[model samples]
Target: MTGKTALVTGGSRGIGRAISLRLARDGVRVAVHYGRDDQAAKQTVADIEALGGEAFAIKADLEEADSADRLWQAFDAEASGLDILVNNAAIIAPGPFAEQTQEQLARLFAVNVQAPFLLVQQGLSRLREGGRIINISSGVTRIAWPNDVAYSMTKGALNTMTLALAKELGPRGITVNSVAPGIIETDMNPWLADPVAADAAAAYSVFGRVGRPADVADVVAFVASEDARWMTGQYVDATGGSQL
Candidate 1:
């Protein structure tokens, strides 16, 4: 991946941050995309540079309709072509089915589903023929999570999109897949700060431990590598055998 280029959305923090760093270490020049958090984005780029890797930060709010265009425009200005596209930026609207507002439902889908779909659609031209497309999905798509019904739905849609895209782009040798993680310890899951909540969350996994950002990042690295060239249109579970 020394001469390759990759883009990781939401690359400033949490799991996205780890993915950005890992990819950079693997010799890929990373375009770290962040919606907000200018400082975090800068820090990620600095970290990558410190490791003798090349990286640059780009900002675009995925919730907005024109995010895809804006992101690609910025990317094109920095690099000539892309070898990997990681759709890791997403928002979760946590609530019961009845408690979800119309606006919440719409925004959730817009950011989590629409943004990824549009990104891939607009990025196809720039993405090389044998490039990789990885969607950061969630284990909720296969498990029951009533507390965040709508968030789960968004991931389900993402999974379907991955399957369809893998088939559609197969002729061009572009492998598309979804990686589903469970109970990851990130800012998005603040409840993990509580010892009791953390233990309960850990119990969901056979490993009996909370999933780390690096854990997911490592799986993503494999998927983005030439070693995974034959795998496509599959849901690669990074869930630690959760709910098994």
Candidate 2:
């Protein structure tokens, strides 16, 4: 991956941040995309540079209507080709089905589903053969999560897209896959700060511990590598055997 270029959406924080750093360490030129946290994104780039890796930050709000186009436009200005794309940007607004508003539903779909679809569509022209498209899905799609019904539904759609696109792009030697993680400890889940709540969340996994961003990032790194060329259209359970 030394000369290859990769883009990681939402690379400013959480699992996205971990992915950006890990890939850079593997010798890939990383384009770290962030929606609003420019400072965090720069820090990620700096961290990569400090380790003798190459990285730059790109900003585009995935929730915006023209985000995909704008993101590619910015990316094209810096790099002419791409080898890997990690769609890790998503919003999770948890609530009962009935409590979800029309606006909330639309936002959820736009960010979690539409953005990734559009990004891939736009990137096809630049993505080299044997490229990788990895979607960061959630384990909520496999297990029941009524509180996050809308968010989970979007991931289900992403999984379907991953399968279909893997077949569509197979002849081109590109791979598309979804990685689903469960009960990850991130700022998004503030309740984890409570010891009791944290333990309850950890119990969901057979590992008896909360998943870390690196856990998912490491799995993603493998999917992006040449070693995974034979694997595609699959849902990798990065959930530590959750709900088993």
Candidate 3:
């Protein structure tokens, strides 16, 4: 992956941050895309630099309608072409199916599904031949999550997108796939801080522990590498065998 260029959306924090560092460590010049926190973005870039890696921070509000176009435009200014595109930015609305509002549903789909779809659409020209496109999906798409139906639905769409794109882009050698992670230790799951709740979550995994960001990041790293060139349109589970 040395000398290759990759963009990781939501790369400023959590699982995305881990993926950014891991890719940088593998000699990929990273464009760390963040939605809001510039400080976090800058820090991620600095950390990569400290590791003797090349990285830069870019911003794109995924909620906005034109964000995808703006994001690719920003990427255009940074590098000549892209070897990898990781659509890791996503937002979730956790609530009962009956309680989900139209507004919340729209935004959830906008950020989680539509944004990635449009990003790929706008990025196809910049995406190099034989490049990789990895969508960060979730295990919720497979498991039942009645309380967060909208969130699960969005990821389901992402998984479908991966399948369709893989077939469409195969002629160009651009592999498209999705990485679905289970319960992970990140800001998104703060209840894990509670010992009882943590144990409950841990029990879902045969590994008997909540997953770390690095765990999922490592799977993504492999998927992004040439080692996974033969793999595409598949949901690479980084779920620690959770909810099995």
Encode model 3's per-residue lDDT on 88-151: one tens digit a residue: 9988789778889999999999999999999999899999999999999999988897988999
List clashing residue pairs in candidate 3: none
- lDDT by residue (139-221, candidate 2, tens digit) is 99899999989999999999999999999999999999999989898888998999999999999999899999999999999
How many collisions per candidate? 0, 0, 0
lDDT scores of the candidates, listed in order: 0.95, 0.95, 0.94
TM-score of candidate 2 on Cα atoms, chains taken together: 0.99
Higher-lDDT candidate of 1 and 3:
1
Q: Supply the global lDDT for candidate 3.
A: 0.94
